[model samples]
Target: MAYQVLARKYRPRRFADVAGQDHVTVTLMNALTQQRIAHGYIFSGHRGIGKTTIARILAAALNCRNPIGSELRPLAEPCEVCESCTEIRAGNAVDVIEIDAATNRGIDEIRELRDAARYRPSRDRYKIYILDEAHQITDAAFNALLKTLEEPPDHVIFMMATTQPEDIPQTVRSRCQHFSFHAVKLVDILGEIRAIAAHENVDTDEAALALLAEAGDGSMRDALSIMDQAIASAPVEDGRPRLVAQQIRELMGTVPNAVFERILQAVNDNNSAEVMTTANQLLDAGNSPAQLARQAVRYLRNSLIAKISGLTPESAEGGAAAELLQISPDEQRRAARTAALFTEEELTRFLQTMLRTFDELGYRQEQRFHFELGLLKLVHLRRLLPVEEVLSQLAGGGGGSAPRAQSAVRPVAAAPAPRPTAPAAPADTRPAFSPFADTPNRERFQGISVGHQPEPVPVAKTAPPVAAPLPVAPPVPVAPPVAVAAPVSPPPALGVPPVVAASPLATPPGAAQPVAAPVEVVSPFSAPSTPPPPVPAPAPIPVAPPAAVASPFSAPAPATPVAAPPAPAPSAPGEPASHLQDAVVDALSNAKQGSASDAIGDANFILDGDTLKIQTMLSKIMLGVVVNADAEKILRLAVRQAGGPVNITLLPADPAMKAAEKKAKAPRSGSAQAKAMEHPIVQRAQSLFQAEIRNVIDLRED
Candidate 1:
């Protein structure tokens, strides 16, 4: 007999022999012992993890003449001694049939299967049909056998094994008992391979066995296959093959995990030179860049997991680390050590970068360059400070200063001090929300030359007025005189412009003192350049003689100052009205409103003292847009920028009369589309192309 590979030689013949699938094995064994068998069974999960093996085991158990094991046992073991079991295990059973659905996936084949399932078994008690890779079966094929699969004959059973269960039609899946299998764990694969190596009389180191198990990636058959190759490549000593970790590494086309650990250490040290050198060495040694990237991604993933598991490298033998990182104990230790060198976030970023590098290497032209670049990125990534950290430093005022700063302008000359007889009045309390609380802010914006500044008015100080002499003839007594002061200039501050101050008005003796109105400070768009004209003082109130008694019910009338008419807003100096209009047009054009700018550019702009008038021949829609709130705001801002007048008015240029005159001067002509339709050559071209004219443009001027 030819020497058989370990995969087929060690294939499980009974459910109990299968590893990592006890949940499925136990349930099927119970059903078999109690004689509760379903007509259809669908086994699905990761490949090489016992999906098809379990299906075959179940098939053998169902057809076995004498099934062993009592109710207390985990499974009803198939008795190999029986003739039916022997024949089925040998793959020559007359009643049991195994079909590869990948090749025979069609409606006709399914119809034939449906016809064959109706018949009773030839020798065994039941006729079983096993379909492997059942997901490859066509939807029509599944539908063809749907009714039969739902309610198959009692003498027949259908067993299916697939890697993807979702591809199976819902109607067919609902009619079957679905059992999902899990990937064989690392420990289980390690134990199985170790036992198999010992049984095969092959000498192997612990690391070699671990490497083989890790290479399996959660598949038992894959591990066995790789072990078979490893045993073949091992050196023979004393008629027994000797397997080592280095030999296995060479055979699997992978370097030791320590290589990746060193790279990550370089990353932690922020050594780009070391990282690129390591990548160059790996590539020069004939290892694939894509393969290297793949290995790096895997290592980084394991390291990130180790960091997230919150385990120390020394104690990562058998807890969450062992459960999540499905590698050998040595590899887990390496991952844990790498994780310690960086933070959780840094490890996560490294893993993401390597994953992208691996994906890019699949189609990249210069794989080596990109792979080195990716590793270099890890080094730079280590130097980055977290956003929260940077922000905290900034908020704590420990970070570097901003890139730019503004220097204060020179201070204007100060006005002379007021006389001692005229005491200054108490300063007015501004509201909390007022923007003028800080005078420095105003001076900071003095660079803007848009509107004229208002002249500053000096604050006037008033004293208690003296009472007038009584009109009674008895020699009226006179009150003591009170002294008043003239208005004074604003406080001298740096960067502030010199304010034009006004003189105080004179008053007759014994007259009442009039209070001045509070100055109105407009928006930043407008500021004072000149002071208002002084107003006349009010007339004095009459008083009774000192000897006479005054009326207690009568209240003294309050004295209020007369308000002067508002001064006209000053226009921008040196900026002509036409130049300001052109500036406004340029501003609108810069704002990306080309049509609006063109329409406004053609309109007439006239400045009449403080008022600006705009006359336009645009339509009502265009007119509405020109006068809309947004457009009006833009116009005002443009005017301010150009240092023009703020008060603006818009007027339509007699739309009805203009429209009639334009119509009268218009030439008599056909529409462009109508003229194109009348052309014989154009009609022929349209007929030949089978095209419709959606739009027509006339190049000729009217």
Candidate 2:
């Protein structure tokens, strides 16, 4: 006989001889024993897991001229001595026809097979058609044979074996008995390889046998094929081939898992130099960077699995670890030891990094740089803390020193300042008392208590029970000189008025203020012949409620106390309002409202009698910022600062209004776009981000 590969030489003849497929074998055996055979059978699973082999054995068992054992107790296995079994095993059976579906997957071939299936057997009890790689058949071809496969004649049987069962049409699959085969486990492959090596009289160590089994990757045919290659390459000793682990490694062109284990150990130690050195050594030894990356990915995956399952060599037997990690015992132990140095998450991240690096090596020009960088990434990734841990540290509620460091660095201002002394009344804890919280009291102005009038009124004879003692005193006539001489440091007993009077423009409220005097000089006609004499301020605009008072001595107050009073409708001041425009523009620009500042800066400012008019041409986007309520308030405040108050009119150019009207008239309805525009959350986001809605997709079902 010619030299035969181990895959073929050790091919299982009877169902009982098949390994790692007891589920399929035992079920087929039961079906044979009961003689409840289906006309159409489909076998599908991983490659080389006996899908076609089981199909052929079932064929032999069905047609055996003299099946083993007696009628009372029949063995479901085929009788090898029978001529039908011998011809089938030798692939020369007259009645059995094996077709390579990959080559003949057209409708014409299927039509021929359909016509042939109608005939009776030539010599055997039944005619059998075994189609290998059946998934390769075109959809048209499967459709052509669907009717025949569904109701084949009793004299014919159709058996198909395919790696991808889903590629076969559902109509064809429904009519056939579909058996999904499992990938042969590592333990089963190891035992089978050991037996084959013994039978072939080849001397092999346990590591060499394990290596052969692992190289198969859970396929008996693949394992046997690798064994054949290993035996051919093994050195002959004492007239027999000797298979060693080192020789097998060289034949496979792969470094041992130990190389990766060492790399990971360096990573755990955060030694980037060692990692790069190891990668350099592996490349120098002639291992391809892409191949090295692939091996690293595999090793990392095994380590991740070991970390997750806590699988050691001694504990890996007959469990998920055995099925998941299909390597030898030594590899499992190596993976476990490596996994111990890193956490499950770190292993997962390492696997992910290597997986990405492996994919990049396929298309990247600089493979060596990417491979080294990928290894260096593993070293750096070890230093990273999980997001949950970081968050816990930030919360200052975790056990690690990270939380302590986080708490130590926190700003002292984060906590409220301690009160020097408690108030006579208990502080209000109600939400209404909070500045941010809304309260009805915030809407209107409150009463103001003036200490004295400018006309030198007499002091009150008796303190009114409703009035405070401080407001009963008359104003001192000599105070203006003392306040205007220079900046005054407030005295301990100086009240709120002294603080206001001590500012740079301390001339009486009615005087031509020093800041506003320059605006008059720009226009001769707008200036008065002589400046108006200083006049006492009018009754200080009614003060806010006591709770809203802004005083350094008092508790923190709401922003309402500092709000500028509404500008009067008309005030005939004797100066042009250019100073007001400059102030408004400067304020807007400093507030980061650049577009608004530009619009205002380009505007024409006219002081007609008592009204101030601002006119500018702006785009619709800029018009929104210029006319914003906050911007309007700032404009009015600037006018108040320039003089008493005046009517302020902002006239956006007609083109801007026309553009805005056109946009508003643009179609909007109850569609997703309209709803998204009108959504409160969406509107708030638009305002906050200064964005507009361009499109909206409705993902909800109709």
Candidate 3:
């Protein structure tokens, strides 16, 4: 007999046999027991999570005969010996139909299914339709089946399985009862592996089985497949089954614990040389660059977690590291502590560098060199100061420089004072000969004095008197009396003018006044008399008037002023009013107006000023218009023709408008209006134009 592949040979036959999906199993069993079966069922989960297995089991339970007690009847755990259960398990059941939605996803296939559902089951109580990868079904097929799914026959059951639940239409989902499956846990996966190994008589350790469980990645099918490979690789001794960690690792091409440890130690010690050497060794051993990079990052992350929790690498528990590296909880904690020495930012930088280097490694034929280079760079980073210490040094300048002096001093000797009998004073005003002066210990003010010295009188000398030119007398003017004004007194009697008071000690008020004062005044006047005129008084300052105070009961101000602007002089009645004449001329000019009843001609007009009153033979309309004196008169006429309360904003023609108009009028292969009308969006807009014509006045380009 040919050897059956483990994935098929050990395929789950019943809900109880399905690994890592008890929740889903229990729910389905309860639904069947209570007879609360839904017409449509949707099973969604990752691949190998038993979506297809549970779906088949549910089908079996519904059709199983020879009821086991109520406890087991109508549940997922159907007896394999029963006809319905055994046939479904073998994929030979007549009533249970399995469809691969990926291949048969078309309207024709769905229409056939809809027609088949009208028939009764051949053997079982109900006919079951199992659609795998149901998301692959085409939209037309789904639409075709929508009516059938919403109201299927009493003897029909629809079981749809999809890994990507999001792809299914909302309408289809609303018609079904949905079940979500999760990946199997590591412990649960390991337990299943142990059970299978025991059944197969294969000898294995818990650690080896745990590794296999991890390699399975939560997929029972994958785990069993790997187990089959491991069993085949096991050495044969008397046909006994034997498996070991080394064999498992070798088969999976995983790095050994020792190699991982060596790489980790190199990084921790900041030994770039060792790190690169080890990386080269890994490559020489046939490890791919991407695989090596993934392992390195995993190791670093595990180390960080261990370091933060103060655990050795062996002690660390959880995360990818726990699942990949077979490190003990203690060792994991130790590695984590070592990783904690570096900051998250630093580690993240290292990881990013590794990522970039890995990208380069992929393209390089000689990947060992680039891989080693990346390792060396990462190790070198460990030698640099940690981010915190670097930040501290930057903040405070390392706190190791010398202090600087704040002040300087110098000594000085006193200079000799001038002779006391002479009027000249000493160069240094501070006294030098005082008893308390120049003493460092004396109080600041105790050594100081305050007083005035009398001026020295001129000494009368006994020199020979000049006897010649005997006694020439000088002319002396009469002295003027001091005049003091009193409030009620008339201006002081002018018999003698008030004396200009002379400063005291100026020849005792009788000395001749200086001649230099009059000479200085005369010198300034001798030059050109071009003195500037006095500044004029500033113009009267305008002050804002005080705000008016209204009585408490005064009426509120109108929101808008009611007074209308002055109207322009009406055109002479017989002279043909400007508006009517312009309208008549415009009517006569537009002879080729498209249609016989094209009212008002092609001319457009605007109303002028406020309270626009039109008096036309056809009808009368009032509109509000405000026109500036400089505004174009033609625009005012255009506003008047617009009629009603239309707000016709007349803008000054800008440079852009002039350019556009020029372009529009230029000769071309096609009319500019026709070209503009050609755009699909523009055509759509034109269709909508009439409906939105009333809103045009309020439309702004922006």
Better of 1 and 3 by TM-score: 1
* Tens digit per residue, CA lDDT, model 2, 626-680: 6688877766766665552457877766764645643453323444567788889
Segments of candidate 1 deviating more than 4 angstroms:
67-75, 387-702
Q: List the residue pairs that clash in candidate 2.
A: none
Residues 202-240, candidate 1: write the lDDT tens digits. 999999999999999999999999999999999999999
- Which 10 successive residues of model 3 have the least lDDT summed? 516-525
Cα lDDT of candidate 2 equals 0.70
Instruction: Choose 1 or 2, whichever is better by lDDT.
Output: 1
Q: Write the per-residue lDDT of candidate 3 for residues 345-382, one digit (tens) a residue.
A: 55776777777876887788877777777787776665
What would you estimate as the lDDT of candidate 3? Answer: 0.58
Measured by lDDT, the strongest candidate is 1
